[model samples]
Target: MGFSVRALDTDSWAAFAELVEANNGVWGGCWCMGFHVKLGKGRTAQQNREEKEARVQTGDTHAALVFEAEKCLGWCQFGSPDELPEVKSRRLYEKGLTTLPDWRITCFFTGKGFRGRGVADAALGGALAQIAQYGGGVVEGYPEETDDRKVSGSFLHTGPMSAFENHGFTRTRPISPHRWVVTRTV
Candidate 1:
């Protein structure tokens, strides 16, 4: 089966909501706003969710979601280059990040039964397409990977190295052995 990706706008509210709920609130009802809350800064869970929802309502181009049939299988939060404090604060990212307008795939979450089945890969590819359609050429991602260690998908919501690499992202730098910034130019 194939999955489709789309923006989490007003039309996708129900699907998006369902997607979040089905994930056991792994993101603390974040709506994927952890990076949007600013690095080195703090905000309540409700605050993050509210801010994210407001951005979506105002048509902030940085937010997105992916769906497979009636089920939303994946999400890649992107757009808003200057607005994403997490990526902006990274020293490695600070050094040679593109000045051109870009989209940041800050986070992802795949449904339980649909995981490890290429769902995130499809969603990310679709996200790259959406980024291009939105006039974005540089799509960025920061993902974590491990050889055999076990971790919850919630903890790995930033995604994994294999996922982005399989999608043609080049490793720009290694933030750590397990974490790296990977990017794909489209």
Candidate 2:
């Protein structure tokens, strides 16, 4: 079957929730809100789930969902800088920033049995296309450069450098030892 993608809007909420639930709420119940909101101390997974669900219901969150014949297989979260407040290695990323990007690709999640299947790449492409529909602008992403080393899929939730580059993003700067700030003018 061919892969397809869609924005994670109200109509697609059910499929997106199913994908997150299948992954154990994503990164210990992050619900893909790690960059969008700061988790207070003692925040429960259920709370995070509730908050994310609310965001989806109110059309506050943005993401691109990858699917194969109607079943969502993965997703990539993208939004404006204000929409996604904090990111990994914020200090380092700030040092390299000449100007704030119009959009940021913050997180990615692929289903358990769907890793290494180009789900992330498809999602990234989908995200760029979605951004274009809103009038294209600079899109930034922080992804790891594994350098052929052994790395777990869980550690690549933000995605990998190669995937972003393959989608036409250039390495703008190094945000961390293994992570880079990449961008593309969409």
Candidate 3:
């Protein structure tokens, strides 16, 4: 089935919540806010959900949500450097960061039973298209490169190297053994 993509705007908040809820709040109550908000003590899944919902309601949420008909199946989060303070590898990324990217693709979350079926690729493409609408610039992403090694879907929240490459992103530098900073001048 073909999919449609849209920004995580107020109108789409319900669909976004449904997708995240289906995934158990996404990575242990992350609510796709790992790069946007710091995790703290006493945080609960409900709190995360509420915070994310508030962000969406206030138009602060920046993500591309993929829908097969009306069901949200996947998402790709993107934002300006200031909006996303930290990434997976802060130190390494900082070392190679000569300049901040106009936008950063921080995370991807595909619903259960929907992975490995081009959901992520669609999300990334949707994100780039949205960025282009806002006047494109340097877009950065940090994705894991397994190099033929077996890796779990849970470990690919930032997405995989091949998906980024498929969307025209090139490796800028290595952040970790299996993670690299990829970029594209979209």
Give me the candidate number with maximum lDDT: 3
- State the lDDT of candidate 3 residue by residue for 61-99, as single tens digits: 699999999999999999898888779889999998899
lDDT-sorted candidate list, best first = 3, 2, 1
Spell out the clash pairs found in candidate 1.
none
Instruction: In candidate 3, list every pair of residues with a backbone clash.
Output: none
Write down the worst ten-residue block by lDDT for model 3: 52-61
Give candidate 2's error at residue 137 in angstroms.
0.3
The lowest-lDDT stretch of 10 consecutive residues in candidate 1 is 37-46
Q: Arrange candidates, best TM-score first.
A: 3, 2, 1
lDDT score, candidate 3, position 88:
86
Question: Taking the tens digit of each residue's C-alpha lDDT, what string does model 2 give over 97-151?
Answer: 7889999999999999998899999999999999999899999999999999988
lDDT of 3: 0.90
Cα deviation of 113, candidate 3, in Å: 1.4
lDDT of 1 by residue, 110-169 (tens): 867778877777767777877778776777788887667987676577887887888888
The C-alpha lDDT values of all candidates are 0.70, 0.89, 0.90
State residue 161's C-alpha deviation in candidate 3, in Å: 0.3
Using lDDT as the measure, name the better of candidate 2 and candidate 3. 3
Candidate 2, RMSD to the unseen true structure: 1.2
Q: TM-score of model 1 relative to the true fold?
A: 0.82
